[model samples]
Target: MIYNTLSGRIEEFKPLEEGVVKLYTCGPTVYDYAHIGNFRSYVAEDLLKRFLKFLGYRVIHVMNITDVDDKTIAGARAEGISLKGFTAKYEKAFFEDIETLRLDKADYYPKATEHVEDMIKIIQGLLEKGYAYEKEGSIYFRISSFPEYGKLSKIKKEELKAGIRIDADEYEKEDVRDFALWKAKKPGEPSWPAPFGEGRPGWHIECSAMSMKYLGPTIDIHARGVDNIFPHHENEIAQSEAYTGKQFVRYWFHVQHLIVNGEKMSKSKGNFYTLRDLLSMGFSPRAIRYLLLTTHYRKVLNFTFDALYQATASLKRITDFLFELETRNFSDGQTEEARNMIEKTKKDFTAALLDDLNISGAIAAIFEMIHWGNKAMEGEKLKKKDAEQIKLLFYDLDRVLAILPEKIIEELPDEIMELIKKREEARKNRDFATADAIRDELFKKGIILEDTKEGTRWKIIKT
Candidate 1:
């Protein structure tokens, strides 16, 4: 089950088509570099997509890159470059960070600028349907025509009818209650020619047009940050459903805002941070992703340096357990109970995630598995087959968590292998001084030696 933002309750999820899911996740605006707060939502969305695929659903994910919004226009003007040219560098930076964060690539990333014709067609349809009005050179969605404008936002019609929020959106329209569908061309900003006007599509219309073009008019899932629940998403629902005469979205998933240092992150307060900022300070990207994944998306995440350090420690504990298990000597016979426990833990983890993405429950299940493995090993009851079973389960779980280290250890260099062999001999002959010297030499060469009950197993230190 997943929480439906529209219904404000947990509901069973079923796709329009069996064994298939259409997911639309709101992406970055590309006006500037995305911060950790923005990535909080992306990480949550990625987890959901991965979990869906793991459950045997073929997910067709669509993320829109909003490159032609008000922010982009102002940023382009500030940089004295063409709109696309200015946004290109930041968009490139955004994708580079996406790779660093290990987010799964969406099937389609529809940019708003490339789909003006699509937006115009939707706007024209609304106009023909009497759900919209044209004034001067601009078109606006008539809120009065669509009585269910505030369904998703829980905003009352009386509140909007009281006095419109002009500055929050375009104000050239007839009523403050109505939002812009198409804006009139301004002197410096970019514009697109339409039958209604010569201005670009409003921000809300862009999603409706692009999502319908790729997915159908009705989609299975629509996700974004909590701040978008109102105004942006609410506007999309108003225009989209009003034009199509059907439901626009089935599940509305929204991630709560992220706070930093026990307060809301702000540029003026000097608490704002981008992903590069954390990496430049020598924090691992794995740790960053782990921290973001621990908290439920519905809860506000208070990110701090101390928390990130703790995240690194937690991850190291998991990896160290795996490494020890891999290198240790085990008995010949397999433990049947251990295999059953692995299956149970896997089921528990999946159940927790399916229950509205309860990350804490899933994390507890992982630690429980680790605790069991350690207890079995301490009792000398863990067999080679049991250890292998536990490791396989973790690898499967990592497909959704993605918090473990990605590098697979490969063959060691000849010199390193020779040193390892010499160290083993030194230890066997009780040559303590030579073994210590060899270990120190290999440590300097970026290989770490862990002496297990079976033998000395060396790991390559990752920079």
Candidate 2:
């Protein structure tokens, strides 16, 4: 079951096309690097796609980069560069950041600036349908014509007085709330020619046009930040349905905002942090991903240093558990016992995900398997096959979590291997000083060693 923001109910998801999903998510504005609060939505959407693929659904994902909205133009003017040039720099950085965070690339990234013709076509269609009006060389969506304007947002048109208009893309108006679909060209700003005016698409119309261009008139799944449920997504519903007389989207999935100190994270409050900011501060990408993915998407995640530290430690424990399973001697147990445990784990994990992506529950199921593995080893009930089962279970789950470090590494340098051999000899020959010195030297070079009953193992610690 999935939570549909439009219905305000949890419903079983059945895609319009059998075994396929057309997913569209709101992308970065491209004015600057996206903050972590923005990524909270991106990462959640990434999780949704990953889980769908895990469940054997082919996903066709499209994310729209809003490169021509009010914020982008303002940023271009400040930078003194062409709008394309300015947005290009940040757009490049945005993809790099997504890769750094280990997010799966969307199948399509339709930039709004490149798709102005599509937006104009949609506006013209709305005009022909009597859903839009031309005003002062600009085109505005006549909210009164679309009687179902407030369905998604619960905003009552009756509460709004008539003869009022709002030209600003995002500014809330107290009286008139007719939003601009095509703004008139202003001095020193980018503009595109349309039948109504030579200007640009409004922020809301950009998503509608781009999403419909790629995903079609009705998207199987549409996701955004919960804060966007107001005028942004609400307007998308109005314009897209006005153009094509079908329901705009099947399911509206929204992720709640990330907060700091009980307040929404934003640049104005000096509380915003980008993915680069956290990476520069020495936090591993996997740890950051784990911390974010472990939370339920609907909950307001409180961003805190303490929580990050705990996330780091939690990931370390999973790695340590993996190491113990691989190195220890566990060759004496019944295969049926381990097989049953593995089946139960897989069942529990997938069941949690099926229930509206209950990721916290899914992860808990994984940890419970880890706990069982550790206990089985202590009781001499774990065999080599059992160990393999546990390892493979984690490998299967990592398709979604992506938290574990790879078990295999390239061969160590000859010098490093020679030193390890010498250190082993020194220990056996009662040369404690020599063994201690060799171990310290290796540690200084970022190699960490752990001795097990079977043998000694060393891993490279990225410095």
Candidate 3:
């Protein structure tokens, strides 16, 4: 089950096509570097994709790169470059950022500039269907024509003050809320030859055009940030259904914002931190990904330096468990109790995720297994088969979590290994000061050691 923003409730997920899920996510406007708050939605969308695949569904995901919005136009103008050249630089950086955070690439990354023809076609259909009108060379979707205008966001026309709002991209519209389907060509701005008479596509119409061109008229799921629930998504529904005369989307997955220190993250607030900023602060990509994904998508993620440090520690625990399972010497036999615990953990993990993609609950189940495994390790030694089962379970869980390190890290340098050995000997010889010094030196070299009852195991901490 997953929460549907349109329905305002959690509904059982049933794809229109059997065993296939068509997901459309709103991508970023490539005007500047994407901040951590922006990635909170992207990471949640990635989790949604991975979880669906885990449930044996073939997903066709499409994300749009908004390269021609008002912000992008201004950014290009400010840089004294062509609109294409300006957006291209940020587009390249955006993809690199996604890769750095381990997000899965969408099947199609449709750009607004490339789909102007599709937007023109949809606008023409709306004009003919009497759902839209032209005013001063700009086409606008007449909100009064669509009686169910506020259904998705539960905003009522009566509550809206009668006024004129002319924002082509991101703003609230009331008093019939007629939004632009196509903007009139402006001086020194990128414009395309269209039936709408040499104008650019509006922000709301870009998704409708690109989504319909690739995913078809009706998409199975549409995921975005909660801020889009108003003018943006609301207008999308009005214009899309007006053009296609069918439901625009089945499920709407909206993620909440990422907060910094109990306030909404904003540059003006002096709380904005981009991925590069976090990385420069010595936070690992894995730890940042873990921090971004650990909370439920619907809840506000409160990000802090302390929270990031804790996430680093938590990820270390999981990595330590993996290392222990990899190197332990055990005989080939399975304890029935251990087997039962493993099976139960897998079931609980699946059940939790099935319940509205409850990832936090699923993580709890993993920790339960980890706790049991630690206790069992202290008693009767785990057989080789039992160790493999635990490892396999972790691999299965990591498929959806994706927070685990993907590779077995290479061995530390011989000097670093010797230092670790020296630290172990120092502790054995009751020389606490020497042991502490060796540990600090290794820490500076990006190696962290945990003293388990089995022995001293070290993990390479990515700075």
Candidate 4:
């Protein structure tokens, strides 16, 4: 089940094609570095894709990169560079940040500039169908022609003033809101020639055209941040459905906003934080990912310094568990007791994910397993087989949560290893001062060491 914003409730998700899901998500505009608040939506969409695949569905996802929008044009003009060159800088940084967070790449990243012809085709169709009109060489979708204009947004048509229009790529009009399908070419801005004359695609029409070009006339799911629900997504439904006379998308998934230090995040508010900003402050990408996924996607996540510290500590516990399992001795046969517990955990985990992707519930189930696994280790009830089962279970859960740092830790320097060996030797020789000194040295270098009854293990502190 998934929350359908259009329907205003949780709905059972059934894909249009069996075993495959056509997912389209709104991507970054690429005018500037995306903040943590922006990433909150992307991370939630990633979780949805993972959960769908976990449930045995193949997902073909497309995310649009808005390279030719008002913001991009203004930013490029401000920098005195071509729009392509200006957006390229931030676009590169956007991908780097996503890679740092370990998000899987979408099947296609359709940029708006590359799809102007497609947008033109849709505008032509709307014009032929009498759902659009040209104003000053710019074509606008005639909302008055479509009676169900405000269904998705629930803003009645009567409330909208007729004859009013918004020329900007993004805006909210109080009257009859006839949004642009194509804007007239202006001096200094990028231009593309079409039947309607030389101009760029509007913001709302870009997603509709690109999504239909790749995913067909209808899509299985359309996911975006809650902010997109109003003029952006609602406008999408109007234009696309008006063009094809078909349901635009079956399910509309929206992730809520992120709140920092008890207020909405914004640069004007001085609470804006980019992913790199958090990383520079000593927060691990994995810990940030973990904190982002802990709350339900629909709920506002309140980010704080204390939450980051808690995420770091929680991830350390998981890594320590993995270290213990990897080094511990295990038997060949599966322990029936451990097998039963693992099976129950697997069942609960599946249930939590299937029921509207209750990630918090799924995480709770994982912590429950970890708690019991640790107890089994302490009581001698955990055999080599039991340890292997628990280890495999962790791997399965990590496939979804992706919070483990083992892959990241493998990149640590060998000097950290030599220090660990020296620390071990100092302790063996009963040289307490030398051992303490070595530990402090490693800690200063961002390496944290933990000694257990099994053995001494080390982790690279991300901060």
Candidate 5:
């Protein structure tokens, strides 16, 4: 259950205030559709929240949308649309993608554009504290003032570069190391009026301002992709700690990047795959989520068609087993072996998740449960009540796994329903030949029929 913090590894966790967890996750800068790589971070965050709830902690998760950033401004201009319109389009897409992934909804979804006043007030505080200075037409955080600038990323101060701005602007600051707090007014760019001037907030400043505004100066956890460790998160730490003079976050959890062919997935690489792309290719969203959970959150997940196919097959096996268990009968009394196995699996799964959300290990524990359940069923050693108990145990495990239970009773059209009823009646009358002919007729129409202890089930087979 140890968590690695930027300061050091912590073996124990004590909430800042009992029973309350304030979590801040760096959300997408909505300019375009989010790729699968982006979804990986969201999935990791979702799991963290779920695990926290499992541990009896009340979590207040807040994810801020960078509705106005350099990228958003550029995108709006390029598309000849208003900043509001551009951000709305991409934000909707991001929400839809994550919703399909079944990631838990954040308690608060704050947008940067809506928090300009907060950003301005924070910048004002930094200015009053001498941690920030106004440059030509912009406000920049004086990196030298914050002695611990490189602490979060562990980058040495001597090796740091100046003016490493992500924006494509011609205005260069006198010091390249000084990052922006506020960008001076520019034509064709979104702006808000403040004491400094009419300008927009910087990329890194938005999160610090919005997070602290909602979740106090210090939060329980702050999470983002590992790529944001430098510059983005580093700057956030510097600005937030400087303004508040307190710890910004107790635990900083970062999920590793999703790679394709050993290269990071990015828009610049032109090799990124969006969730929509996978869906269009006939991959189920559940299978995509399964593929993600199979790998540890901190490990680099290398995605490929083969990996996805394997995940699909594994998910199908679990679903089929659950379907069978639904119809089987078992006695109420628990077997010692089964009880011990369940307790061990739960312990291992919790330990893995607690250790920086080691999802791969937790998934392996789930497979062990599946194996035990399968064996118990095959030997008929499990009474009807015992089998029911196993099924209930799996449902508890699936709270974090988020996989839906398999449907035992397949849906049928009115015509197909009538055919199945006729076939069943014929079988009851001992007319085997007629029943066989009807089954063959249904099979020709892309339906595969199966009879279980409960009743008959049919599946539509896609060609």
Candidate 6:
């Protein structure tokens, strides 16, 4: 069951029609590299899509890139590049980093620059309905015209005036609560011809226009970071619903911030780090994903190097166990006791994932299954069919874990293979000390060598 933040309740997720989900996620501004805090939202959304696919739903996901914004203009000016060149550079990097993190690609990645006409049409509609007005050369949405302006944020309309911050010279409006729909063309800045004038769309309006252009006036879900709840998403709700005279989104999902060392990560404070930066520091991509899944999506995740180390160790153990299981030759079938244990494990794991995507509980269930599988494998007189059933159980649980399956078959370098051979020879000669020394050498190189009843196996230790 999916939880809808708009209603503040959990409901059986029935699509607008049957068998399709229309989802939208707020994408990056493309001014710089996205830090880890930004990825928490992407990871949360990826998990949502994965779970939905596991439950047999076809999803059409759309995310927009804010290529033309205040930040993009300022960054382009600093780098002496055109706005097009600046946004393109960062957008490419964003895709590469997300691929490294193993995030599923969106069905459509719309850019703000490509949808200027759609945004102009929406603004024109608002102006015709007296919900928007032009001040000087810019267009602003009149907040007072929309009676349910604060419904999504639950902020009272009377208290919203003081929360708005507008420049006095920009306009002499009656209310300080108005937000911009379009900014008039400025000198040496990117602009295009529109019905209103020569200018560009505002940050908030771009999302509503792009989403509605691709997914219609209403969608199944709209997701963003929690920091966007107050002004950005609230403005989107106000503008879209007022223009279409219908609901904006059915479910509103937001992910909490990722804190580092008890404080929020910020670029000005020099505490910000990107996914590439973490990888250069020897953190594995799997370890990063593992650390992200340890906390719930709605809760703040406090990340530290120590926590990453623990994740690395935990992943290594699971990988080692799976590697051992795959090498054993076995046939298909199961004893009564082994079949019951596998069924119980599968039931527990599915139940945990069904309840609001409880990933932590699901991980605990995986470890329990691993424990039982190991014990079953250790029996002296195990049936071939029973051994195959145990291996299949691990594979089934991995559909959600996404950590163990990748580690089952490892690629070893020639040097590592030579060391393993040397260690094996020493062990056969009864030279225990020399064999232990060779094992330590492999550990120093981030390779773990394991000895099982089947044979010798090795895997890359996530550091």
lDDT of each: 0.90, 0.86, 0.88, 0.86, 0.84, 0.83
| Candidate 1 vs. true structure, TM-score | 0.93
Model 5 clashing-pair count: 11
- Residue 359, model 6: lDDT of 80
Please provide, for model 2 over 380-413, each residue's C-alpha lDDT reduced to its tens digit, 9 standing for 90 to 100.
Answer: 7889888987889888988877777765343689
Q: All predictions: root-mean-square deviation over Cα?
A: 2.5, 2.8, 2.7, 2.6, 3.1, 2.1
Better-scoring candidate (TM-score), 1 or 6: 6
Clashes of each: 0, 0, 0, 6, 11, 0
Candidate 3: worst-modelled 10 consecutive residues by lDDT: 167-176
**lDDT (Cα, tens digit) per residue for candidate 5, span 138-249:** 9999888999988888888778755445455624655577789999998878889999888999999999998999999999889989989988989999999999999898
User: Could you tell which candidate, 3 or 4, scores higher by lDDT?
Assistant: 3
Task: Report lDDT (Cα) of residue 117, candidate 5.
Answer: 96
Kindly report which residue stretches of model 4 are placed more than 4 angstroms away from their true locations once superposed: 162-176, 408-422
lDDT of 4: 0.86
Evaluated with lDDT, which candidate comes out highest? 1
Candidate 1 lDDT by residue in tens digits, 374-455 = 8888898899989888888999999999887765454798978998899899999999899999999989987889886767
- Which of the predicted structures, 3 or 5, would earn the higher lDDT when compared with the native? 3
- Badly placed stretches (over 4 Å) of model 2 are 160-175, 329-334, 407-411, 429-445
Once fitted onto the true fold, the runs of candidate 3 whose alpha carbons sit more than 4 angstroms away are 162-176, 418-437, 449-456
Please report how far candidate 1 places residue 309 from its true position, in Å. 1.0
Residue 108 in candidate 5 has what lDDT? Answer: 94
